[model samples]
Target: MFCERSSGDVQKEDKSSSVAVILCFFGEQQQGGVSDEAEPFMGSGRFGKSPTSPLHHVKVVSSPFHVALKVNFLCQLFIRLWPDGRNLQLHFRSRLSLPLFTGGKVEGEQGAAIHIVLLDVNTGHVVTSGPESTIKLDVVVLEGDFNNEDDEGWTEEEFESHVVKEREGKRPLLTGDLQVTLKEGVGTLGELTFTDNSSWIRSRKFRLGLKVASGFCEGIRVGEAKTEAFTIKDHRGELYKKHYPPALNDDVWRLEKIGKDGSFHKRLNKSGIFTVEDFVRLVVRDSQKLRTILSSGMSNKMWDALIEHAKTCAMSGKLYVYYADDTRNVGVVFNSIYELSGLITGEQYLLSDSLSDSQKVQKWLIYTKNWFDFDH
Candidate 1:
């Protein structure tokens, strides 16, 4: 027999002819009394004998040896007398961005996803519908690094004991989907992946912690959610990672002095300049003949760090416009790799004079400098 209701619900009553009550889990903490007048302890075979039914005085404080641990401790003490008794947390509704490589997968920093909520710290609600909204949490891998300006006045047991420190020796290994259930109180965290590489730590940074995972009876009293310190590296530094905007068929050694085969990637693949849209169509048609083909083994600061890392590639607005025939004199505006965008000039066009012996402006400036070895 058991029943607790401040609207936290937990009921189980059957009183078959008396003597069923049994509260000795340390005699309700040395008789702090929750109402009882003695007489209850009859057990003898099938722990039975129900004849006149009478049991109804159970205020047992702790040893719930079953019935799912007394319905998980009266649903975590009625979620600390819920509704307004404060206390409840697990925040990180997203925050863990940056180049986190190692074995890869953890995203955000423009990739989004990585949630985990639950909150309620005195009505800032989000405990969505009670019993801590079907808890499950977990996601570990934390070690030190936190200071939102010293987390202003802390205290949810100091941010749930500030991620109980973990990483020291062989730690990293946090494979994919490290548990996640909660639905209305949020959860997300899917493809986690870490597998080592905190770059020989000494605060090379790393953090993620969550909690509440153990036979799910998470009866509230939440509080535990880290994730802000990040750095994973070494998946061969994601092939020299640094592609904020870069991506037009990537791989021109992912920019920055193009090192895949080094020496400015063998002089941009022996000058045919493979991908990154063929080095942004030869740096928009002849950046001084692509800096005279890597200025003799490159240097003007490595050709301005490979033309500021191929000007952070992200072009492809798909425009074309070209005109020279009907005398619109010049109109040029290329893109989608024809590069040059916008140059119309006709009021007695001069464009620095010599229209190179115009055969229709030298066949539209040799079809925008052989728009990538032009075949069609």
Candidate 2:
């Protein structure tokens, strides 16, 4: 399970603020006690031995903040987890309302707007319920206007106006902020338990519910969301935080430590490779220089370490590095080469920067090879 929140103030009305929250779960559950061999034949041959069961008893609640505004709403959807399996239910509840101008003008709207959507990863079935009744979850905001006079078909304004009218009833603003809760447990097949010596203990069971508050705004541009995951356990022994040095070959340790202690920077500086700015210039001048240094067969152990570090940094969203001359320096001076390469290549990386880099490089990499999109 995971939870995330977006940054920046959500604008609903000129005076109101808002934010968005997202929660996700890795649905893992066991149902029928089919053996490994017979399992493959249980539900036709399509899924092989995979068991299908609904994520039952899903519940959602709205936040008091929204309720205070007299904006209350709820929506529920039943999605099939398997071809013939029970339906996994999802519920969304919110208590916010769409602001109305004295007349019907939508201009000068500056408040935040919030929207929530649920997607079934297994089947890619998405169910969205919000206050903006006319907005489709797939395409919430209109990007630009179309010129009707020049075009042969319907004009852009007419088309958009039609779309707006068609979707006015389904807009998210009509629903409000949503509160979601989920309950998962063993089914009629019976619960399975593993014991240490003699006690028969039931499997760890619990439910999760979350309330996300976000501001809503016009122009549905993409924004970043943050999330976290945690577990509650009841163990007998006293738990203690432990820090262990990475094994000689552990790539994660290698990457985190790279240039962290200024060792690499110091080495480069000693060899006349001054600041990160200089490094960036060198990379732009000759990308192979840094690659040669990193890929050179100096020590198998060190090479392995660097590779591992890079991978770890890529996964952890910590690929960006910063350098500043003093406390007063406001802008970031340096970033990880791995991150830069990912952006330049158009593949998804853990981090990306726009101000310091050129969009042409980004576009070129995205069109040419696989580069990481950190935001993705």
Candidate 3:
């Protein structure tokens, strides 16, 4: 029987038989309950031999019988133990490469996707070999902008509590595929969307956390893997959101402060301005008329947002030059509903002589069209 001491020493309870004990950085051996040469564990000396070995402390406890070996390496101790007279085995408790989440800011309610992979912090490389090659990951939503860098020293219960607070005292309802299986240490979280917008607060944002699935975390110690804080706009806006360089046929409600069947939409519709084309034409032809239509309820900021969105509409490539038969003084250039006369001037008068004759009008129109296309 042996007993571990508080000090850095080992002693046996039995005093009758003589015993010799020798402990090495590589392994330990026993002769008459002790040995002069240590038995090499795992066939290697990772902790090096004595004098240079980091193995500074060894303790043996009896009754159930176990040996606790502790070493100082990288500010952390590598602990190994032998229990219940079992075969000597080495357990490496060293830090491992962690999984990381990568992808730019997420677009909420858009079925956004993100990526995850095992990363070697020491080498700064994506690790695809070993147990990380193929592993299952479970993702959860976390509170963004929370204090405590990268959630260090946080427990599972603490994380869950924070998540509950983040989603307004309710656990976030994450929909779509959340369990991702990696191949070559890389996996994509596809078609994942949040059921609720981030909490309404100043600088409000949300984060996603990833962890190894229960059965798959056997050997991998995946440290905190989370995304940067990001905002998620209400999903309702998605239906009215307009793409850049919007098509001419896009609805008026796509503009800011304009909702379907709302006051702005009703007013615009009453004025026969239904599509973006109609709105653009009315703005070009009668600026005050368009302003007066929405001037009652819309604010300057709202008007700016509306105009900015409308400006992104692409004009028809086809151009037409129009003039009155009575006089060449009046001329207008139109590309779809957009009046381009403001962009080009004086040149129209030069082609007036050819345009004046009614019989030659069609012929000169083609010539004018070709000239404008070539020049501009």
Candidate 4:
């Protein structure tokens, strides 16, 4: 016999309450107005509920069939919320392991390694899960002909773009400031120095571009020397000093007088004919005559003076002469006559005797002979 307990207490001998009946009553009541009333209570937080928690009414409807249906609905909702769950699961399941090379030294070798750390931006977590999620470090020591102009012909646009493109999808791998050491001998000719001033590399993704730019060694600051000295030496191991002779020296002759007098003197002087000009004019006018006289009996001093004057005027390239022999053999000559004293004296004597009446005529002829010559 089953006897239900009334309001206060029940004897242990009459404890026969059925769990199924209690569940049936709760379900019937919840399906009625109790469910409607519990809807507000579900959101009221009275039961410490959350969005992810099962609904209080639904929890009460805990039949095995309904529970299975709720679980299936939850799974469908989860799949809809995260469609890439399969891929994410696969990525997490197949973790990546990278090989590391510790620092080491070899004899007669210089080397360095770049340490890289990759992180997930969304969660600030180390991205060590997938095979492709890693930082690849390549240690490449580039050596080539630095003097090749082909490397130096980068346009401004190409340079800027090179940097931008390299850094398009990379992050900084360095922390502290970077120091550059440019080996002097390793650079091209006229490279300024082996050490460059310290600079900051804001990002490491652009390091390749920075390396290219730095390798170029452009826009370096140059310092001027306060003073410099140099010494020159001859093959004899003797230090040589520069010696500059005076402008007008002992070797050069100056004109004291041009000619004897009158129109010849006036013409000579007017025509810029100094003593050198007069002497050169006479010799060049009658080279053969002067040579004959010198051969006959001329003083060395006079010959020397004539020779000197001829050389000077010839070197100057300004004297000219003309004359005619007894046979009417006309000749025109352009030269200095200082070297032919015999010829000059002979010509002068002939002219003086032939035109003794007109000194002016003889002088004029001499002067004209000195300039434009027409020997006939």
Tens-digit lDDT string for candidate 2 (44-91): 543322332111122222445543322211110111112223222222
Best by TM-score: 3
Poorest stretch of ten by lDDT in candidate 2? 185-194
List TM-scores for all candidates, in order.
0.37, 0.20, 0.53, 0.15
What overall lDDT goes with each candidate model?
0.63, 0.28, 0.53, 0.30
Candidate ranking (TM-score, best to worst):
3, 1, 2, 4
Model 3 has an lDDT value of: 0.53
Model 3 CA deviation exceeding 4 Å by range: 1-64, 68-113, 122-124, 144-160, 164-172, 193-206, 217-220, 227-246, 285-289, 314-334, 337-376
In model 4, state the lDDT of residue 265.
43
Collision pairs in model 1: 16-53, 17-52, 17-53, 17-54, 18-53, 18-54, 333-342
Please rank every candidate by lDDT, starting with the best: 1, 3, 4, 2
Candidate 3 on 173-203: residue-level lDDT in tens? 5766778887777777655556666646444
Model 3 earns a TM-score of 0.53
| Candidate 4 ranges with C-alpha deviation above 4 Å | 1-273, 286-299, 302-306, 314-333, 336-376
Q: CA lDDT of 121 in candidate 3?
A: 53
RMSD of each: 14.0, 28.3, 12.5, 34.9
Please identify which of the two predictions, 1 or 3, would achieve the higher lDDT against the true structure: 1
